[model samples]
Target: MPCELCNAFENEKSRIIYSDAHVFVVPILHPIKDGHVMIIPIRHAENMKDLTAEEARAFMTAANLAMDAVKKEYGVTPMFLVNGWEYRSQPHLHAHVLPSKTNLRGLYAASEGVVGKIEASVEELTITADRIRVHFSYES
Candidate 1:
């Protein structure tokens, strides 16, 4: 089967908030909260160990940028979640930058579920993506 992150990376429809040689950052299609985003490596790394040195550094850089943006945008230091194995929704390794009080991967594993649907609309995603991209620009 084709990798989801690869597809997303190649898919023109995907809203990429930030990107570099090693990784690309995008807002999660189904976020636990509004400001939640993902820092995904370009390679199909299923786990942290799979990432090379450059990809790891790029991933961390993306994480830092996403966290900084989330803090600046939401006024809160968001949670960083590294999902893998049975807990991961997708095969590609991606770390979620969540701005919610609740822990995601663990909480989702143990609890009944989250409070409500976090599926963002296309328009919302577009606006959110645009807003986030501004943080990476010198204009911001």
Candidate 2:
């Protein structure tokens, strides 16, 4: 079975902040903090070690834009996180754009994913995504 994150990314019902042919950014189901977002490569590459140069670049672009958008839409600091679990199911490459003001230790303590006190609404997410696309994406 595919990882649930892949399925969640496909569902338009979820809050999507950014997307392109090579990548997409969606709200974290298990947010590590509020305004938390996930920037994912379209192709399933396990982890950083597995990502090709092109794929890494594309994902980085998405991550950079997602962080800017998140900060603009919600006043909070964004943290980029990647946990590689080769032994885990569906080890795809994904970047977590988590926004938080709390200290580092308190940040990782939330097992279920820290829910950022501020979350982007569906409309806000769309707008932020569009803005990012216009400013940074090739299609822009």
Candidate 3:
């Protein structure tokens, strides 16, 4: 299927509260609260490190605009979350915004959202680091 986020932007999905060429702010498909929404890059960035400068700016703009609206309408602080790299769901970069009453707790179960550590011994770390070292060069 075409990516849901891209489809949303192209088709101008009803859930969208704000949009620009590079970003869209829309409610989560399954919201934890009435005002929960996501600020997403329209261009389908799976990770923030992959976002272009234009998309980054647009993401920030959409986030501010959407969060301000959410806070105003809901009359509360808002919680924000971003997942990245292997810990993230792929093919879309999205920031979740949910209204917070006292910022006491999150709406979702901790197990559902928590990312567990990938424990490695020093031997394993050294092996991984050796493989990754080729991507960089030291200053002369």
Q: Which candidate has the top score in lDDT?
A: 1
The sequence of per-residue lDDT tens digits that candidate 1 reaches over residues 24-135 is: 8888877666777888888788888899988898888889888888777777788898874465778889999877664454333443465533567788778778877777
lDDT of 3 at 86: 62
Judge candidate 3 at residue 64 and give its lDDT: 70
Error of 2 at 113 (Å): 11
Task: Summarize candidate 2's per-residue lDDT along 50-110 as a digit string, tens digits.
Answer: 8778777778888888777666656676778775354233466777776667443233454
lDDT for 123 (candidate 2): 66
For residue 59, give model 3's deviation from the true position in Å: 0.3
Using TM-score as the measure, the top candidate is: 1
Predictions in order: lDDT: 0.77, 0.62, 0.60
Model 2: per-residue Cα lDDT at residue 94: 76
Clashing pairs in 2: 32-114, 33-114, 33-116, 34-115, 34-116, 46-91
Off by over 4 Å in 1: 12-14, 84-86, 101-118, 137-140
List the lowest-lDDT window of 10 residues for candidate 1. 103-112
Rank ordering of all candidates by TM-score, starting from the highest: 1, 2, 3
Listed in order, each prediction's TM-score against the native is 0.81, 0.65, 0.64
lDDT of 1 at 37: 86
